[model samples]
Target: MISLLFGAGASFGAELHKPVPPLGNYLFDKLVELGGAFAELPDDIKQEFRLHGFEKGMLSIPNDSRVINPLQKEIAKYLSSFKPSNENAYVRLFRSLREYAKHVNVITLNYDLLIEHAMLMSGAQKVSYGIDANEKSYSVLKVHGSANFVPVLAPNIIFEGNVSIGCGAFIETNQIRSLNSHEEIIKWCDSRQNSDLSPIMCMYNKEKRVVINPKYLESKRKDYTGVISNTRTLIIVGVKYIEHDNHIWDVILDSAPELIIVDPYPSEEFLLLLKQRNITHTLIRDSFYKSVLKLSLHIRSRVKIDPQI
Candidate 1:
């Protein structure tokens, strides 16, 4: 079966005019709102948010600082609060795809609830989020965790192992910044270990804590690997090929599936990289929503001819 993998850009067309903020802007605004010192912050840091890509902005966060760590937490909080409306163009596209596919699985790296909202609006009677033993209809796997998901809390900092810093404060690793506190929680989410860490968490409840555990990492790894092993065709939307996310490239390399990449302005380096890897990919120099619409027509025409055989 074919799998649809979505990047943040896939939903950008719909969110262009909406109140939803990008990662860089979201983080920067939250930091300033939380009474952090943004006045002395470097110009480069502000510019980082304006970058055309997601990874560049996300990775710009400092690794071992309390400021960035807390900022990560705030970012997760912001995403959770982002309520998606059904009026967006991408939402309509999602509805159309669901109606056509009927039983196909969708895997998305975006943290937004655009896909989920679309599914609900489309009247898909049966829908599953992750690995479901009894699910038979369509499913959506948010590889990077979604803003709507509430993660399970763990006791005594499970994954990071209780380590204290010289300042007498506990130090959390970057992985903690990526996953929740409980390993089992992430396992339940079916997030891939090698997948880019999505910052989605439930921070509204004052009593709820975050857990990032081994099971979570393993689950994420398993989901990604399973998709790579099983999928025959992969449609990548709104994702730019960045060096930091080479793990995705690795999956593409190993899977050797027919790839269709949809982007408005693709880089020459990305095209060169695909050629270098000997991976076959069709670059659509158009909006993802438009490309998907065109692809859907072709897919339907092809499906119509199957019964004649």
Candidate 2:
């Protein structure tokens, strides 16, 4: 069995509709163009972004600021605007893994719906988003909260203990209110332009806090642990192994699966880490689309050698 992991680079390379999503550093400029809450952002804040970085710049602002809620809403609106092309690497990869759907798991660090969109476009009728693992369907785990994931706050719910007001005035980690369709998600995003509503996304932050519901978070983590620990191969695409993401990397290290990383330029630190760990891995120095073609052929050849694979 094999599982897949994706990062922001995967989305940047994906063939989505015109004006593809930008990486973290370039995100602020894109949001500015969208012209909702971002338009209200102060010039000094923009300057801070230019100097330090997106995450650190965001952290510099107080959590309870007026801009945070609407900022998250605009993020959802902008990301949800893009539609995945019918025949992209994302769709092709899903097609390749369709036969092994039961045994495969997909984990992504992106906030966009590209993976979900690709799965549906690939003729998938049932897709699980890690909370409810379906052996009969593909499991796409969004480690960082997704654009479509909305928080459902009960009146009785109380916020406490290092809760991030950066996400919103209040954080709801209990029940997740998932928008079923793209139209519904768009409507939700557009509904509250100036309202105090926020999506369940953990925005660009160096701290990497997960805003997903506790129940859902636990289930997804379990699924991730189970799949990564026992899978024959782990395919990582366009992901940078940074120190802050040790929660993710540490698990891979402990499991020690056969790693197959697809990145045009693999960082020296990442390569060194792989060598130091003494784990078996293959580095595919290429883009996502070209790498998918190679992977498809490789899967075909492997299946021919061992039919059960």
Best by lDDT: 2
Per residue, candidate 2 scores C-alpha lDDT tens digits across 1-309 of 667789987777766344567887898888887777776677888788878878877776566534566677777777777677766788887777666555556788787887887887776787777733343456688877777888776765432323345452354455776676667777865654314456777657786544444356556666677767777788899888786776678889888888888888888897888899998988898878668877665555544233332
What TM-score would every model get versus the actual structure?
A: 0.66, 0.85
What lDDT score is found at residue 241 in candidate 1?
A: 69
RMSD of 1: 8.5
Model 2: how large is the Cα RMSD against the reference? 4.1
Show where candidate 2 strays beyond 4 Å: 16-18, 131-136, 153-169, 192-194, 210-219, 298-309
TM-score of 1: 0.66
- Model 1, span 1-309: residue lDDT tens: 566777757776445456653533344555556554332346676576456333354445443333333444444444445545666655665555554554345787666666665665665665566644122255677655555444333444333223222322222233333232234333433343312222343111121112323344346556876876677777778776665564456777677777777778776887887788788777778775457566565345433333221
Error (Å) of candidate 2 at residue 299 is 4.5
For candidate 2, give the lDDT: 0.71
